[model samples]
Target: MMPSLERASHWLALVCRLVAGIALLALLTVTIADVGTRYLHRITDGAIALRVSGSVELVSYLMLFSLLAAMAANVEKSQVVVEAFSHGLSSNLKNRLHGVYLLGFAALGLILFIGLLDSAAAAARHGEVTQDLRLPMGPIYYLAAALSLLLGLRSLIHALLSAVFGADGEVSHGE
Candidate 1:
């Protein structure tokens, strides 16, 4: 890889980590504020009407993004793997296994992409809305689907790099 490309990847990964952390913090803040407002309103017999509607939708979005960020880290560390067969495999066989893993990830990514489309369509048809805030659920599902797709793409890339470069800085899943 060129120096610039490697640097870009590293920067992108760092940004993803930062975004995931911020999102989690936002979720925590929202939850705490909602709870405090609700409690205060009840105690004072005030009409605060603090509702946490659509927050769950936001949670789902943030959760999936956080998951994808974690998955990206796993890919960077080469820490995601199918261990059931890997543990018994010889070094020579591990190379072949990695190739198979790549192919599997490609297929899985395609399948997940299709499923996400279907889910989005279904959500549109049903007009599913979040209970409290009436936020559409489509976006959350799409976010999760996108994360799954990215994970699959990262797996495929990892396999390609491993196959071509032969595990220079690769971190083993076992570690």
Candidate 2:
């Protein structure tokens, strides 16, 4: 990779990780606050009432976004393999096959990107919103679509590196 491209990739990876971390933090923060406030309400006999309405909806969205944001960064690290079947395969053959597997994932990510784009458009057209939070679904789907596109791009790059340059080191899913 060129120096500039490598730097850009690092920046993108950092941003994605930050987004994923923030989403997960939001999920945990909301969960903890809800639980604590619920306990307070119980202890005070309804005097200290603090119900987190729409918490489930918010948490689900946060979780989904976190996964989407992290997808690109995690793609290279989370390799799944059936070692029993491939134990006898040569290194070159294994790398080529792994490249193909990554390509499949890339295709899947792109397909998801396209589907999410349609979902975003449909949500915008219908004025759709979350059931409990009432948050607009279009923007949410749009952001997810962007993340899925990044996932596809990242997977494609990994596939190329693996097949052409043998740049990938085998990372076991077991770890």
Candidate 3:
């Protein structure tokens, strides 16, 4: 891979992480606000109208987008491993297992991509809206679809890179 391409990917991943972190923080803040409002209402009037508008749902979807967008960085760094048994394996076996793992994740990403896209389209067509908040679902669905598609692209790239470079351990020198 060219140096510029690698750098771009790294930058993209970093942007995704930043977006996700901000969305997550927003989600937390919303949750806290909702809780505080509810508590105050309950103490004051004994009946709390938990009237959180579409922002609540918006934050939720944005949070998911942030997570999906950052997936490539996680995979590239091997930070998403369940490595109890793999740590004990021989180098050859570990390489083979890593290949399998990468491929499996790529396949999963593809599935999620297709599914999310379809769901997004359906939401748009049907004009689906959240029940309680009456928020438009199309934007959330579309955002999720976009994020999932990006994740699939990232998984595909990582899988291809791993196949060519050999996924031996945490640190990849790149072939």
Candidate with maximal lDDT: 2
Per-prediction backbone clash count: 1, 0, 0
Over all chains combined, what TM-score does candidate 2 have?
A: 0.88
The best candidate by TM-score is: 2
For model 1, the superposed segments whose C-alpha errors exceed 4 Å read 1-15, 39-51, 54-57, 78-110, 168-175
TM-scores for candidates 1 onward, in order: 0.64, 0.88, 0.74
lDDT, candidate 2, 1-175, per-residue tens: 6333344445666778898999999999989988999999999999999989988888988998899889876777666778997899887777767777889878988999999999999999999999988899999999888888888876776677666666553332223
lDDT of 3 at 135: 73
Residue 126, candidate 1: alpha-carbon lDDT:
96
Q: Which parts of model 2 are misplaced by more than 4 Å?
A: 1-8, 169-175
Give stretches of model 3 more than 4 Å off.
2-5, 46-51, 54-63, 78-96, 167-175
**Whole-model lDDT for model 1 versus the true structure?**
0.63
Backbone clash tally for model 1?
Answer: 1
Per-candidate Cα lDDT values, in order, are 0.63, 0.80, 0.65
Q: Which rank order by lDDT, best down to worst?
A: 2, 3, 1
Pairs that clash in candidate 3: none
Root-mean-square deviation of every model: 5.1, 3.9, 4.0
